[model samples]
Target: MSAKALIFYGGWEGHEPEACAAIVEEMLQAEGFDVRSEAGVAVLGEADLARFDLIVPMCTQVSIDQVPLERLCTAIEAGTGLAGFHGGMGDTFRDAPAYQFMAGGQWVAHPGDILDYRVEIAQPQHPLMEGIDDFEYRSEQYFLHVDPGNEVLATTTFDGSHAPWIAGTVMPVVWTRRHGRGRVFYSALGHQASEFTNPQMREILRRGLVWASRTTDSRETGT
Candidate 1:
């Protein structure tokens, strides 16, 4: 059977939530996953979630009712994987403690806007970072308030731009965390559709999705 993947997108139209979901769905489909795309958090029902193998929330500033939010949490904890990029996943549901706990981190700030920055690979051996090297990109330097327990995969160096006084700041750009029995992978990139189309970025996302999916063996085990 093909691996099932559901993409929930919407909120803050300026970010092009629909476009982001399209790209993600296409990529996951190409990776042999049966992908489903939807807009808004309301579509995240228990039935919809139970039928899928993974959940990709592309909704920026998602404000879901307690019912759907709880359903999502329960499904994920039962071993459904979750993955996404930028505000769609991280900056969303800022006031929802359950959402925050499931996401493992929150997007607190993006200092210096979209500027040239250097991303350093922190875990080269990780499946998501494998065959990838440190690269430079002219994008927003995401200053995320990350969970201390997360396994960081990549970081970006902040130069003196937004604040002249704070130079040489290092920030986590990619990470993974375990929430209950679920796996969560988050990347601070993809502020726009163009960013997702980058070959390197696309590869990073594709690998991350696969790595975040439910596996027959435990993640802690080499198997």
Candidate 2:
């Protein structure tokens, strides 16, 4: 049977949740996942969260209720995969520490808002970064509070041009971590669906999803 993947998208329309969901859905479908897409956090409460092999949350600045939030985290801990990009995953569930804890980071600022910046591959030998080189893209340069345990795949250096305090900061742009038995992958890029349309961005996102889904308990996990 094909692996099941659920995409829950809603909240903060400015993030273009629907558009981002569509891009992610199409990509996962092409990869042979049986994909299910939903509009709001309500669906999260309604479903048996553990049924799927992967969950992609395409939301930003949204409130997820306690019950569903607990189930979602539990599901991941028990071995479901979670992956997403930008605010969709990084900035979601403001009040939920479990969500942020598993995601390995939280979106604190963009530094310069939307602008041009370069992404550097930090672990070129990692499968997620394989064949992907340092590239330039225009979008929000996410400044995040990240877990030091994350296996960082790519990063970007802050030039302090936007925020003087953060100048010379090197931030993780893509990373993967294990939350219990689950594999969690995230990228700081993809502020808009159009951003994913870029070949390089799209490839990274797609590969990240595939990597997350295939991950298993053989991978290490910790606090």
On TM-score, the candidate that comes out on top is 2
TM-score of each: 0.92, 0.95
Overall lDDT per candidate, in order of appearance? 0.81, 0.88
Please provide, for model 1 over 12-72, each residue's C-alpha lDDT reduced to its tens digit, 9 standing for 90 to 100: 8867899888888888888788887877776775356766778998888767788888988
User: Global CA lDDT of candidate 1, please?
Assistant: 0.81
Error of 2 at 148 (Å): 0.5
**Local error of candidate 2 at residue 153 (angstroms):** 0.4
lDDT of 1 at 16: 85
lDDT of 2 at 62: 89
Model 2: what TM-score? Answer: 0.95
Runs in model 2 deviating more than 4 A are: 214-223
Residue 79 accuracy (lDDT) in model 1: 85
Worst ten in a row by lDDT for model 2 = 214-223
> Taking the tens digit of each residue's C-alpha lDDT, what string does model 2 give over 91-149?
88878888999899999998778999999999887877778899998999999999999
